[model samples]
Target chain A: MSTDHLDGNAAAGALREIFTTDLTAATGTCASCGNVATVAQAVLYTNAPGLVGRCPGCEAVLFRLVRGPGRAWLDLRGVTCLEFALPDPS
Target chain B: MATVSRGFFGRRRSGDPDLPPGQYLVTDFPVLSAGPTPRLRTEDWEFTITTETGEKHAWDWAALMALPAQTPTVDLHCVTKWSKLGTSWRGVSLDTLFEDVESAAEYALVHSYGGYTTNLPLQDLLDGQAWIAYEFEGEPLEPEHGGPARLLVPHLYLWKSAKWVRGIQLLHDDEPGFWETAGYHNYGDPWREQRYWGD
Candidate 1:
């Protein structure tokens, strides 16, 4: 019963490296508990070895990102599908 | 015609020979966290050590406070590349806690109240290397800074000094905890600048 998790905004800086657009608004379904939420709404953990994004609905990890040394590794095994809210390019 | 791109130099590295590589000095302790800090009450809090053979050694808050306390001033280095030097803290040393517990395990995973965990060699936590710190700068630890009690393994990255610490689980084999399984280096040595998985 760890009383820890972080706000979604914490992932913004690290995620910006991999995505052209803000992915925080992107919604995704959780593979474990079938929860749906935006990246920002997930229970995030930043003070670890990497950034962990977990589902707010069931606490399942939605995505994991590790960034350093000019490289980044992202694992989406906890996610089922993602629907992005990209802005219209005129 | 050619296109130009941003030539990134790298993460900010300092030339300070004393501090760890790639770290900048921070006067304030940053509130880097997993989520919101778990509210841990000392009255209800207890520290436990689970040995590999199911032997459990535990101490309630009062019992823990009964032990001798040490005042240590040490530097802290975070994996995020921030170094806080000569931080003053008062707490019970892990050596005092492990005085009676007998274990043959080689590795240990430290667990905190809010479900956060990190692993290191059992030796890292003993021999005057670590503590269950409860006070900082002559003040009770605030929740944000892992108050109630937090592991203080200053030699390693600050993450190893888990916030709101509750117990230690000794294991026969290495079991990677939160960050170790995720992307942080298994053996996070600040001197080597082992921040990420590979380096």
Candidate 2:
């Protein structure tokens, strides 16, 4: 049997380099299947050429982060929209 | 070139001939799926091959199990830069499954139970190249590893091996699948390092 690797939450460390806020908790809708789920639920394949986040509902790639030589490429075509929850000021 | 972290050593095995370019050797088989692992029973399982002309070939679990099974030990190379060597699997060859099916289709779109699809050339799947594997490492395949049956094309990137494979749709024209449309190479050959589009 294959080992179960980490989910989208594991990509948070790499994603922090790009986004200002944490993306794991953000809710997004899949453009392919229209299923809404938190980014944490997205399947993540990391340590590759880049970080790949796929929708849990439809299995469509939701986002990709590729770091090149002094450059970064971000593709979010598979996501229809992302809704972020603002932090509560306590 | 991207700068490497100080004292950073990749997980590459020393002098492993089976390891491909830009890939590190790993002993553990990693499970990479797009969604929840599908649990399917053998009694409810069926394999189908459909051609562009609407011709179809079907096989139940028992019929498939009764076929001549071959256990081949092969290396698996994932587009994710991980190559696992000497992995053993048992399955009926695609050649046997496609024995009597007559079609001039140049391409094939493999469909899975989870609605996942991957495309490949017809030639890539023939001539003792691929299989519908249901047993791995002398054990019944697990759902996370594409249990019941999954297409095992060890030559290409592992993503091309669609898990929970249910049917195959032969096409005269090439059609990009999930990852192919998203940005992956249409034909993911690890030997050539064709990981993304225009590689």
lDDT of 1 by residue, A1-90 (tens): 555977778898655744876788878999999988888899887665568788898776788787766887788878998887654645
TM-score of chain B of each: 0.92, 0.94
Q: Pairs clashing in candidate 2?
A: none
The complex in candidate 1 yields a DockQ of 0.20
Query: In model 1, which runs have C-alpha deviations exceeding 4 angstroms?
Result: A1-27, A31-34, A45-49, A58-60, A77-90, B1-17
**Which ten residues in a row are the worst by lDDT in model 2 chain A?**
A65-74
TM-score, per-candidate, Cα-based: 0.79, 0.76
**DockQ for each candidate?**
0.20, 0.10
- What is the interface root-mean-square deviation of candidate 2? 5.5
For candidate 1, the C-alpha RMSD (Å) to the true structure equals 9.9
